[model samples]
Target: MYTANNIADFFLGRYAAEGKITPMKLIKLVYIAHGWYLGLTGKALIDENPEAWKYGPVIPSVYHSYKHFKNSPIRCEHDSEVTTGSEIIDKFLDRIWKVYGKYTGTQLSAKTHMPGTPWDITWNDLKDRNRSSLQILETDIKEHYQQLASKNANG
Candidate 1:
């Protein structure tokens, strides 16, 4: 298990090296990775909970950490200590980058905002309320992506 910061740092270390990653993109990648981890292993990759923000699912800690970048590409010094020292986790992160890292922040946001997605469900559930935050349940994420994995495996 990793902290959300650990996963965020992992992505920053890999993708931000090019200095082309915005906070929005980084957050989305972290959320996507978390979803896939749950789908693949029935476990969460990070302990921090994600809230369905107007943009998409966001880990508040990570959002604050990188929010300074705003819509600009983030600049950071990579830290190796963020890793969990697990080969399995490293491999899964690599796969996540390979599969989803190529997309722009807008593209990733579109994916997360798709109808019936965890973000979508949470957002819809709370859109009319005066609430400032809506939690995207881990169970919903796991089940949704697990079904996606199943479909991919079958077809």
Candidate 2:
């Protein structure tokens, strides 16, 4: 299995190859990729847990790793090879980029915050008590994205 850093590095290398990316967008994209991986393959892409933050779903480790960029676009120093040795994962990451890479950070955040989403459920449940963060359960993400896949298939 890939760790969050490995996945983050993969995305940063891909998206930030020529340009830069904000931490908010990178984290959201990683969260989306993880959810889709769970939905499609019934497996996790990474081992890290995501929290429903006020902004959207966030992987804390990824956030901390790139937090120094603040609102600036994060630039990578070099391309990092995915050492997971899984062609399947490499393909899935490519697919994730093709499918979801077009959206901006705000757009992805909107998608994650949509009604009935895992982040929505978790955020709503915790927002009442003024909580700052709530765990967005993997089960919830899997179920939600599974339904989305089914919907897209049926349509």
Which candidate achieves the best TM-score against the true structure?
Answer: 1
Candidate 2 residue runs with Cα over 4 Å from true position:
80-83, 127-133
User: Which residue pairs collide in model 1, if any?
Assistant: none
Evaluate model 1: give its lDDT: 0.86
Give the distance in Å from residue 124's predicted Cα in candidate 1 to where it truly belongs: 0.7
Tell how far residue 111 is off in model 2, in angstroms.
0.6
In candidate 2, the residue pairs with backbone N, CA or C atoms under 3 Å apart (3 or more residues apart, or in different chains) clash, namely none
User: For residues 2-114, what per-residue lDDT tens digits would candidate 1 score against the true structure?
Assistant: 88888888878766775477888898989999999998899988998889888889989989988988899988888734465787888888788888888988999999999
lDDT of each: 0.86, 0.83
Cα error, candidate 2, residue 48 (Å): 1.2
